[model samples]
Target: MITRRLWLSAAAAVATTLIPGPAIAAEPLEVTAPTRVLGAIVAAEGGAAVVVRIDATLGPADLRVAGAVHSVAVSQRGLLDDPRNAPRVGAGVRKILSAVRPDLAATFEANHKAWTLTFVRKVLAWNARLAASPVRGKRIVDSFDRAALLAWAGAVVDPKGQPSPPALARAPKDAAASTLESYVAYVEALVRSLE
Candidate 1:
């Protein structure tokens, strides 16, 4: 189990040699509303806690980012979508319904099982990309450069030296990349100084 610190250090050393700037040769990753919507939900409500389904037209979302608000078009299934699995599914649904919108239950029961397997898959994809990419950015280019560039610096200059950690934990940056299937690799690393 490579700890976050060690993993970051190893990658930082190799940052300079890695591809610079946008992978122009590589296809630009698609950043869509649905993806952002899923991220917004996760960033605010927590990922896969119950796979909360939100009304698509809720308008001006409260992502819990202290002043930043986004309106994402949630592509979600109804809470009652699976009666057989309601015990598991409803737990998540109830949490969201009580906290965000109690009315969702009626809407959910009306449209239960309208679709299936949307929320969990989206959450999984986000996790995969989150773990793979080292460069973190709000937009593809921004994070791609900052994360990778910073990693290179940490690896080459700092090495065993304690230094600032990468700006990898910002909610906006993480959410932005959450649903992207691409944006894999470009690992960057840095050490945390005990300051």
Candidate 2:
């Protein structure tokens, strides 16, 4: 029953009162405030923000899960925001990856606390690695359910390696996004909104 706009407005208000620092980077993110909500598109500067309307609004029908991956087109963003020519994916963005992600629903069923813990850890790490940069604002143009999201994240970040900023940036270009990245983006929005 929560509208996205209302949730974001509340999140931004809460983010400003807290002290900011790199120490928070290592802690697991909890869904304590509207800022911690999983999906929110925002534009922020320093510690103030405005929620954006550019990320796609996906219904169950828009999602297609096959080939062990869920992919959506860039035009979806246009439908959510500007429906002009629509941004096109570059040829270099195409990359086929194997090794499917973990079944997040199954994981949650088995142990909701563990799943939440991993999600919190990954998201906070994602914020530290990316959102902490000068760019300030990072919006989610696309999304998938929890299982699909973890699956996509596992695909982009190697099992034997950690995520690199440059590599994380490329995932979205290839019609994929990391859930942790997007959630942290919500936090960034809160910061911007508060300032």
lDDT (C-alpha, whole model) for all candidates = 0.32, 0.28
Runs of candidate 1 exceeding 4 Å displacement: 1-93, 96-104, 109-116, 130-164, 169-195
Can you give the lDDT of residue 22 in candidate 1? Answer: 66
How far residue 125's Cα lies from its native spot in candidate 2, in Å, is 1.3
Rate residue 13 of model 1 by lDDT: 72
TM-score of each: 0.22, 0.21
Question: Taking the tens digit of each residue's C-alpha lDDT, what string does model 1 give over 7-105?
Answer: 899898788568485643322112122234243323223322223233333342223221234433222222111122323432443344334444344
- Residue-level lDDT tens digits of model 2 in 42-124: 11110011122222343311222222223424333222111011111111011111112122223222332333445456445
Clashing pairs in 2: 47-191, 47-195, 48-192, 48-193, 48-195, 49-192, 49-193, 101-151
User: What's the number of clashes in each of the models?
Assistant: 5, 8
Span of 10 residues, lowest total lDDT, candidate 2: 90-99
The lDDT of model 2 is 0.28
